[model samples]
Target: MSERDADSDDPGDDAEELAWETTGTEIDYTCPGFDVRRDDVVLPNGTETGFHYVEEPQAVVILPLTPDGEVVLIEEWRQAVGRVNRGLPAGSAEPDDDDLDAVARRELAEETGYEAGSLRQLFTIEPANGLLNSVHHFYLARDCEPTAEQDLDFNESIRVSLAEYDDLLSDVLDGEIRDGRTVTGITRYELADRWQ
Candidate 1:
């Protein structure tokens, strides 16, 4: 078994230290979505090096469920990936957004035209801990109902659909659901055993 699977509990006690202290940082490039930054760092053994990473604001992914237990999924064309991505409804948190829950509510409505009767944070994850500076917060949105028309960006092409929870799970397990955040969110939500 792999190291992660081998340890059912805390593994930090036996893990090697690979921590780095950032001495300085600079933004190498910036774009509409994220910025690439270079950091001057001192390694654990006092060796200095440069580390590059992508930085972005925190984002939220909502697993919206209809009253009948169907999951709301989105198929969006992602220019970076050069194909349509199948995943949960997600978006970046706006500067003025009240909090993570508020971001989830807003993104749910804006992307899928659905409003959640009850929303709760399921978990948060860093898709790329080594190379990205962003946290993806996953929310479980229940009793969702159609509310308004999708308010999408000019570059967004999102097709929303409702799928049975089991079907969604099957897709994730069978490799049809490939989005990192989506797979992580589903795994966490199911592991919680709170599906209703």
Candidate 2:
């Protein structure tokens, strides 16, 4: 069943039979995002390996825009990419926060010293498909203004840039903006005519 459809089913006597308990042991394998353990368990008549996975917090990324077709972005050094990556402002989510849009606004100001006058939710993604449980929420900001203080992490070295709307697609395709989220946000916005 699809993730969205799983919760849509009506509860009945069949609900009790939805999940079956495995009667085998579990063994763990990795400790990347968090500690994980897997073990073999008895399932029906055969043995099944059950995995215990750990979780982390969710994250948010904001793509701020102007009514005049301008995209405000950041260019920062990334160790993995071995160079600078230009993209939207993004960061981890906070538990106390009710939604990702709030976090997106916070991160936008902190990273770029720019505050979105208005915020619109875009999309959410599971950045890693492996063991870790993390999400990246995307947002669209309008009429943003620079804040007095920039909330940058101690580990981050970021610069700021603004690209015109009509030219954004070409910029992303030309490799000027190389970050995945950044590229997606830019291309999607341009394609949707949101920049207009």
Candidate 3:
């Protein structure tokens, strides 16, 4: 038997006992930014099934703060949502992107034309682990300032803006800002006691 199977037989190993064994995997569809993958697996109860999820590269989300303690935000058209969405600067890592900090800086510049004097990771999370096999690295960027023109992707339509940090927090608490990544990054930063 495999090591996993052997471990599952241990009486106290609840995690191993509940784990599903992947029998096979297949790509169901492919798109520009992501792919749908289906995995055939055997459940702990001996039932077989297939699970589908989005397969994509890691991403970075930035909460950029200017020297005056304002938060830099972006308003962009999100086709899937069919409306303009306001959020923090974020993007998927490109193939050539080796460092996550560099990716965060690049995305912040590309989306808002801002450069950060210092960048520190806030947290990492899988926003939708059940539906998407994607990870988002959250960052807190300090002393950001406008330094260059936006280098947005061909499909992007974005507008840059700044809001007072307290006001931004209020908006988030008031349900005015609905973007998931933005909400997650903002709340995480706020609760960490490091945003001030």
* Residue range 1-196, candidate 3, lDDT tens digits: 0112244235674767777889998899997889888889999999999988888888999999999999999999999989999889899997778899999998999899999999999788879877887889999999999996799888999999999988988889999999999888888888885645
Span of ten consecutive residues with least summed lDDT in model 2: 1-10
Best by TM-score: 3
Candidate 3's displacement at residue 13, Å, is: 3.6
lDDT of each residue in 1-196, candidate 1, tens digit only: 0011224334585454655677888989998878888889899899999988888888999999999999998899988889999889999976577688888998999999999999988777768867787778889999999987799987789999999998999999999988988889888888884645
Assess the local accuracy of residue 145 in candidate 1 as a C-alpha lDDT between 0 and 100: 94
Alpha-carbon shift of residue 69 in model 3 (angstroms): 0.8
Model 2 collision count = 14
Please rank every candidate by lDDT, starting with the best: 3, 1, 2
Every model's TM-score: 0.87, 0.70, 0.91
Q: Which stretches of candidate 1 lie over 4 Å from their true place?
A: 1-18
lDDT of 2 by residue, 98-196 (tens): 866778878888898888889888766665545544566778898877763787888899998887765767878898767877777767666774745
Worst 10 residues of 3 by lDDT: 1-10
User: For candidate 3, what is the total of clashing residue pairs?
Assistant: 0
lDDT of the candidates, in the order given:
0.84, 0.69, 0.87
Error of 1 at 36 (Å): 0.6
